[model samples]
Target: MDSQNSMRWLNVIANIGVLIGLLSVLFQMKQDQELLRVTLTNDYYTSYITADTSFAGESLPAIWEKALLDPKNLSLKEMRIMESQTFAPINRWINLYRLSEAGIVNESFWKSQVNLDAGYYLGDSYGRAYWEVSKEDWDDGFLPKELRDHIDKTLLNRKLNETLAYY
Candidate 1:
């Protein structure tokens, strides 16, 4: 009877060992699956955020008019950002940046007026916004030629014609 009892105890121990081995294999498989998932997620994100190759590290200098006439002179990064962006009311500065690169937008250009509707439409829905420029930004050559000519000719002459002359 003692021998029989000893044999039963050994069988129970063997069964426990087999169960532990199976659990170990399961755990290892779970770990591998987790690792694979992480790798795939990382690969997807890496492909998503593409970097602009052109003007990646370029700076927009203040000489804006010169920059506009020579867009090819810009770095790839600058071109990419400008091409992709849409201007907003807050990004008045960005409009200036794009204008610098736009090459030609008529010879006589004016800064933004106080009203929001005072700007021109750019390609795509992204309007190139302007600032409500003070009188300081307005200079001799800035206003459109027709408007300037009319102001000088009509308004100035109106004043001259009002002056008294000897009959």
Candidate 2:
């Protein structure tokens, strides 16, 4: 074969090799995602609760119902308080994994990032729920100490910043 033809063939072979490598990489990623421990059963439950109740679990739903029924629990718009009892010990871990998967950290930061994420989610989720019940009457403050305590304004901001550091 002429030198020109030989060069063309080499270029074509290199391109083919790159395509195959990319396909393999994509397939491997798909396999890893498939291996994710997140189960559909749990997803179904969480989605149903969020969509129908504007809530996340049975305990919170039950408390909301009880609060609505009981006259003593009722108070002026801002003071009525109901407790949230999350269904499992799963919330912290799951939120951490979600944050990590979004590339919030490098592998070396995984442990600390996960810890911080737990604190972030704890205060944020409770604060969100409290806001829903109180409208805007409640200040930007987090939930009552009795309900959750992994966060303070200072610590929470630190966790958020740390999680975003790898970016």
Per-model TM-score on C-alpha atoms: 0.31, 0.33
Best-fitting candidate, measured by lDDT? 2
Q: What is the lDDT of residue 32 in candidate 1?
A: 78
Query: What lDDT does each candidate get?
Result: 0.37, 0.43
Candidate 2 per-residue lDDT over residues 1-167, each given as its tens digit: 69999999999999999999999999998776554534532553575356446444455545444443442453443122233222222243344344345654233333453344433322333433443454234332322332232333334454322322445
Residue 38's lDDT in candidate 2: 46
lDDT of 1 by residue, 55-140 (tens): 23345332122234444564665544544331222233223323333432222221221122122212111222212222135453
Q: Which residue segments of model 1 deviate by more than 4 Å?
A: 49-167
In candidate 2, which residue pairs clash? none
Alpha carbon lDDT at 91, candidate 2: 40
Task: List candidate 2 segments past 4 Å from native.
Answer: 37-71, 74-82, 86-131, 134-167
Clashes of each: 8, 0
